[model samples]
Target: MAKADGLDLIAVGRSCVDLYGEQTGGRLEDMLSFAKYIGGSPTNTAVGASRLGLDAGLLTRVGEDHFGRFIREQLAREGVDTRGVVADPARLTALAFLGIRDPDTFPLVFYRENCADMALEAGDIDPAFVASARAVLINGTHLSQPGVFAASMEACRLARAAGGKVVFDIDYRPVLWGLAGKDAGENRFVADAAVTARLQQVLPLCDLIVGTEEEVHILGGSTDTIDALRAIRERTPALLVCKRGAQGCSAFADAIPDSLDQGVVGRGFAVEVFNVLGAGDAFMAGFLRGWLRGAPLAECCEWANACGAIVVSRHGCSPAMPTWEELQAFLRDEARPFRLREDAALEHLHWATTRATGYPSLTVLAMDHRSQFEALCERTGAAPERIAGFKSLALRAVDRVAAGDPGFGVLLDGRFGMRALEAAAAYPYWIGRPIELPGSRPLEFESSADVATELATWPANHVVKCLALYHPDDPQELRERQERQLLRLQDAARKTRHELLVEIIASRGGEVAEDTAARAIERLYALGIRPDWWKLEPDDRAGAWRGIEDAIVRNDPHCRGVVLLGLSAPQDELIASFAAAAQAPIVKGFAVGRTIFADAAEQWFAGTIDDEAAIDDLARRFAILVEAWRDAKQRAQTQAIRETA
Candidate 1:
């Protein structure tokens, strides 16, 4: 048999039309804004491999609808071989509505009933392609349907017969596999016994297994990786690799393999994240890239980590991947020191290096810039107010300081320019400071100080956000000027009275326990400047505040209460405790991005003239606190009255 040329990889499974939208922050009641895009694990994997300069192919069924056409076009554009991509005129394509409440893990709403993709039969997978490829990837979702399931098992049988490597991604959608043949009931949930049995049946045929921590626990019945590995080992000799999102991954190749004496644990790349939708596919692509090049298992795992990091730091899965040249550049530049000031600059550098290495679409940049909010709103068609509410939550969690706002100023890293500022500005309630849009300068501050001096004045209450790089086509001189401005802003943040909160939107969290939020705090701390608050958005559900509580406890510092930007969490007690611990008043800020301050005086401060008396009374109460903090004699009496009132 001829060894596969240029790393032939065949990814077989679901091909879908995905409509993804996320609230600017995670809130269910918030109007969900979103965008539609094509997404599926195996299809994405194929695209990723092709982007890495490998000969990758996708094998799945799609309806002969516009969505199907779009999927084919995307695959072709990405240079993936789609000869085996079947279009069924008889059935509708699988459509999934994904709501990414958190940037890390998202719950999906899938509409897939005998869907076109699930209509795949073994005959649809060409034997020649399987024989030609070195590895074949399959999804458990496809196997949920008996025909597709039989087809995949048969394909694996043939691939094994032909000596090809077989990989299984246990993309277990609990909602999708509910009760197999049983009626939809409590006992018939997809994650029930039936699905577990199906998973067990398929594991023996796979040489490698990739799954989420939850999937592992469900299928293997253990939380411990070692025990899970043992459970998997008993079913199949396939190497077990558990993808643990931020915690990194662990692979058990033993009883023992050459790669590790006992087992292999690979730490994921620490990245500033935007969305984690397709990082898993990116990881698969990276792992294949390394494997094809005869890279050590450890190195393969590193490739996966780096690829996943790159994807999360950017936006959607396939769109955010780095080209081969870009990947090399990032690897080469890993050791280089980051300019102390640019927070998201390092991630941009990573993307830049990856872009230099291979071809990536400009759409990726656009997606990264705005997909999180835009996509969510479109999907949910959420009421505008709800959308604003959710966005405020995300903004509060992230707490991005804007440049022109009265409370705080952001350091503008010129990379995203006005677009970044505008995005921040759109938030109705956030720390987004106003930025002089491109070609616009701070005229108000022009009379009082120089640009740097003016920029620093907002330091006490402002976060200076800077985009360190300019348009990709900008002249080197222009780019250098932007970098210099970033440096100036950094310096200003340090000396000014304001807390410097830098948003490195592209960073990733690794094994260092410094996840994006932690890293953001750490980055500023390393600069010898302490931020009054490190912002973040927790999950959108009722108990989302727990995450903030955990982060606060983990990264204890001289930080105040988090400026919560959304509705009261169901777990208000936990959040209140955090507020008490931080000794910082939890401001019920809006989640409308940077737009929050446009009418800040009216909404947050003024309200209406008719209520002026009440507002005045509230103001007087605050005055007493300020006075009490200053004067001891009247302090006690004022405090007592205020508390009683």
Candidate 2:
């Protein structure tokens, strides 16, 4: 089958949220915490295909709620088209609770009573939309219910009418078919003739069929693998792929062979299994990646086997699937480790490549001043309680400037800016909250020493901004303590899935070297603390900026570019610094606070100016800096184009 102009694959079936137990080798009843991720057979396949550089789309329904929005947003982030994902207002999104009991045992519970995905009716499938994709994958679970069965059949009809292949993943779940008890979700197979009849109705419409040995048994009506393959072959002329857990997989395009080894077999990798929940989905995704391009069946099975092997050694399903680059690296590395989770390079590659968003340029107003704000209240005789109101006014100024642009951000503190932060949550602006205590030499958190506990209360969108009064030349004891604290904070950020921005001030007190900022960043990399962003003071020398860029690229190429910080410098000086650092592509944008707000804040606190006046003055100053940065960025782009020419 030739590829279409639109999506390469459209997976029409179950899409739900999966909450995996954090405590490994434990029962679901004893688990204390869980991590949420997108799940379901077809959904996982779509995500896996998208990660492998396929233009995949999902045809499913989710409830009109938080989880629904999350599913859509995550698919969009993964580069999967969500145009066919419907939000059913009447039903709640489906959820699956999974636990890791042992290497071979995984306990699962499906919370899918009248779920939105299952409620998908035939009317939901658009004929034109189905034909736009080169292939439509329908899972067996979606064919169990009448409503979804009609929808799946409609998609299969539309796909075939447009000369598109219909791929059927025999994702057999006995509980989903009412053949097993509700709590028997972990049961992979049950001998049921009714379920086979239902699945057979869609077999002739399929061009490709994938299933495990047990899944084939359920579909082909026999416990014997060869008998199941031959029985299913008689029902459909599609190619059959039998997944044999660790031994690998075999694909049969013609007559069923006498033995399982008589087909085109692909060898599987030798890796320790963690949870075998999503391996089949990963295998199907990888197989399609090759098959859609008209690759040989042997090669397709190889890709499928590798994907399954990688996923089986990881934790969750969709999140654990390998990216194109990661898969290539794994395939090329002869010395690849047996434990995929312990491979730091592969883990970092996955984490960096799968980030939700990327900010090309950010113009932020940093007003996370705690000690400075308190001191202003002290000097002006204003009540300390009024600080919150002042922060609200400042946020208004930022809102006015960020009316149309999404690149604008704010660095506010929870202590005095809680009201502003709450307001910012309603918008799509980049908002960061400070964690470090003001002017702390050895780096102390504002709230509890347990940074993760403090971060647990924060919104996921809020970036964790921590300012360290760290100098590369500090005493060994002080530097080590600060480094330890920063490491702890970084760990917490990773655990909480919050983006981290580490603001470094290398010239805290003594004379600074030209390469101090670079060395400071290098030191952090050596300690394995890679923040998503670095907030650094702009350097006057081009060479200094180059050194910093080299350090970042050499250490963590996926690190988000640096954002220049203003240390209360004059507006003109700050503008000049922007021009000086403009040539460095590593610098994304600026986050200046005191340079824009200090004077107006002082005037407002002293009662020399009213709220509007203070807000207007701060807004005007902020706009000036934003314009300066943009002008410099444009100039740099023009220079780059000229050099390339």
Candidate 3:
């Protein structure tokens, strides 16, 4: 049985792989290359809806082939449920080649003859899965096939019987309809009495129906556009949305108006057009965003328009589809949430801070800074010899924490943290090494010139931790230098298959900006650099982490979350910061340096306390922080469940 509230939408029908031409202002023959992305109306809508943080699912058939595997994987990665996505071993998945003719037009060619999706059988439909969804979505093409037609009918029946709404996307693809003449101009739709009669059979079943003028004409069986809408309205008062490109779309839930091709429609957020394909699917997703959230009619249309505008300005449909946070963020900015959900970067920074999964609860013992250790030794006057004992104390703590097979990691440098690294190597624990050197703006590094070569030899769990003092307020030269350094590290990790942990301590007092960490993260992604993990300082609110998390997820969906860094603050203060950061799902655990082991180092270096006692004291503080992290993770998850409920 599907979990209650598990699947909000189940979209059934054709899903294909889209090969978009890379070369612009060209014909199909003129294009040099093509970009691959998930395509097809139903698939695009499901992916788009999922990007907006909806609990969506797909019900379709694909060939038991590479393309089919890719479709399922992409959907699952986007958080779409795919249990209903069946693979037929006999046929091939559908494929579409989209060519860039000009800024306004994209020439699309369908290779769907005997495709897997078109071969859907009645036995393919799962009654329980349909019953579980809040809405059941089907495309008009599904009705063109006898076997799939029965399947679509069963889905509609199950959804209605289960008290769920049925949504009809009048996605007219005339080639699928066997229309072979100019009567099928550009393969949009052909106004036919038989097609109109066929669509009318399901008109009464839909709670909401979306289509272009051509699609409405095909569905309503009338030559005149308004007449067709009026015919559908007379049969059923299903909410109708007329998609008019560039001018925006209209909504009618009641009787058709006498107005000539216009009404008091929701205004559209207009932007320069790139490719007009998939605009309809994007509009539907946007409308659903408002309708499902129970927004007013005007606002629903506004959201739809806003979504379409953002998508048009961007590239592919589903990849360009904005998240709820992204859309909300663009809305706030366009007057818009330009970051589209980079706020998720914070959640990525928060609860899920850990990208590598060896540890259940990470109580990191951080004592990796060389300068700090050297300074502590200089100040205490007991001995520089005690620094090795400091690593020893941290190692003891690691051993203690790791007793139950629950893993832990330590941040150590090859300079001062050599003994700690040597000791940690023996155990099955997370090991992090600093790849970038400590300095001011325009950071300096040794192996960064050949980071990829150096990193290729490291252990898989070896997370290269680099600390850079970067903020948007920095000089342009400084920013460029930092970006270059980060990309260097990124290239290394990508080649080595080792984990990367970036610690950006934005220089404060110079800039009193909010979301410094997030902005810094955005800068890295803007440079096409994505780290496996981010090490961040605590924020006052969960919202502060959103940008960082969003950028991480956007740049690399497989990103390990961000961890909290103590920055050597007092233990009491570090505990409080952990409490704030723990509430975020993006935060996996805390990587504390000074606040955790500083006190022990000072006493041990001063000869005021023995090494054994210092280790014990460090162990106690470490234990306290570990318990705090566990407690915080639990509380955050509980709140998450409650919010979901």
Candidate 4:
């Protein structure tokens, strides 16, 4: 029934809104903030492709609710064609909620039943739509859902029949199919059986299968990569790409004589990460971008790694994505092939260098003493003349990095408060530890100057950060205390920035808050600042459940609305809790974070402040976790109505 245009790609299956937050260093109950972002594997990949200048369209369903509208708007903004993204009057869009306490390790969560995306039928995907694309990228998660499994396989078949390629990413959410309810053992077994059957049917027909090593093992029913490839090759003979995360990625050509022989594997470039949310999608985007540009399979792997490296260095999914020009430039400068090895070997350094080239080297020049700083310089092969005291040295390093690197973060020690050090802490270029304004008495009375003179010397545009008071190696209770302390420090830093701005205003009869300064600066350059005018928070602490919702709309076009996070006691109570919050007319989106994470995964743990890497990773995961929860909540509500009727 559907007609297809000359679309380059049509992404079929599920799409949902992702609601998440960083609670690891602290519990949700302890925090006053959360972030809402868009998520859904198929949606993510489609957007990734679009950001790289591909003509990609999303063929999916979302509810006729605010969440649905947000999803549509997001896709349109990302340059994804949503003309085929159907809206379901009967069901709500799927929602996913994620929570992370520690970002370095994995954060866990799940999907809900009967969401709008799962209700997609064969008729929803028009035959012309399948005919229009060069390829159709499908998510394995859809196969676990009801009508979607059949609809997806049929779409794949139709696409192939119409001479289009099929790309399958085995985004295996194991727990999604695992047993968990009171009768979870039996329910999970049955669900696993149904999913396994669906997978067996779809995989063989795929032109390309992308998955992680763990996913390949699970799908192949074996631990061995080669064995798994041989098994899949026997059926579809499709190109197999096994993504190895930080290790990089590998691929198998269908034309290779020995199907059993291991295919080419490439190591990923090393990158310090701010988040790993959409790294996989970024990889797929790069690989496809390169493949579409006529690069060989090996080069495709290189491109994929480079894209992933760039992604991890940044934040969020679509917003953090790199364009085609960025990827091409990175590849031209950094692409190298080498045999993988352990970290201590020369082969390792060679690999690291190649991969590192893709990322401009961001060195964190830290020192407890001048000698330690000098030693680091020696190790990094920096000339002695370049190594000044802590501040100059850090500035030189930042200049070197910024000249070649897109942007990098820095942490400067507070013990050495050089004049340059004060300057570096401004503009988010460096994070200063154990430092306060010149006259702060709590910091051991370091400087005594005319208070006004000192105020004038401070960087007006700098984002002042207080040193975290928590010990990095403390135990549980101690860690919690440290976390609380750091939060207080964050609060203090915010206050200091505000007070200083207020002081500046008193002197000049104007406002000087950092946010105000940022906006004023952006207006000068005709550049747009991110939407920081509003925040999302819980309406009440009366319950344990929370609802993640759509963005709050403000009457003023210049300001963003406050995000609402609703909490209630437990299950059978979240909807009611959300209903209470909805009584207030301005709430944009509703979500249940801890409730969903606990239900989807295991017990929820808060993150520790000591682990910055983990904090970053966990923050991103929380976003994904929130997405799963919102999706599940809508589906559960829709299913409840279906059953009652």
Q: TM-scores, in order shown?
A: 0.52, 0.96, 0.62, 0.51
Best by the lDDT measure:
2
RMSD values for the candidates in order, in angstroms, are 22.4, 1.9, 10.6, 23.9
Which lDDT tens digits does candidate 1 get at residues 1-645? 226352378888888877665354554335354445567889888878888878888889999998898889778767888888999999888887655455544555667877898888988877877887778898877777798898888778878887888999887765566633322211112336666677788887788888876667656766654565667778888877777676666677767344322456664556566667788888888888877667788888777877777777644566667677666655665553332113443433333333211211000001112233344445545332333333222223233222222332222222222344445554422233432232211112111344455554342324443322123233556534544444455455543433333222221212222243443334334434333333343223323344334544444322443433211223333233333222222221212222222222223223333233333433343233223222432343465579899
Q: Each model's C-alpha lDDT? A: 0.54, 0.90, 0.75, 0.53
**What lDDT is reached at residue 192 by model 3?**
74
Q: What digit string (tens of lDDT, one per residue) describes model 2 on residues 1-645? A: 335468899999999999999789878889988888999999999999999988999999999999999899889989889999999999999999998989978989999999999999899988888889999999999999999999999999999999899999999999999888988899999999999899999999999999999999999999999999999999999999999999899899999989999999985788889989999999999999999988888989989999998999888899888888888877887777888777777777777877876888899999888898899899999999988888888888988998956688888999999999998877778898899988998889998858998997788889999999898888999999999999999888877778899999887845677889899999999999899999998777888889999999999899988999999999999999997688889899999999999999889988899999999998999999999999998998898899999
Better of 1 and 2 by lDDT: 2
Whole-structure CA lDDT of model 1: 0.54
lDDT of 4 at 286: 75
Give a tens-digit lDDT track for model 4, residues 127-207.
877788888888777787668887898889988999888888877665555445422211111224455456767876787
Candidate 4 Cα lDDT to native: 0.53
Off by over 4 Å in 2: 1-5
lDDT of 4 at 213: 70
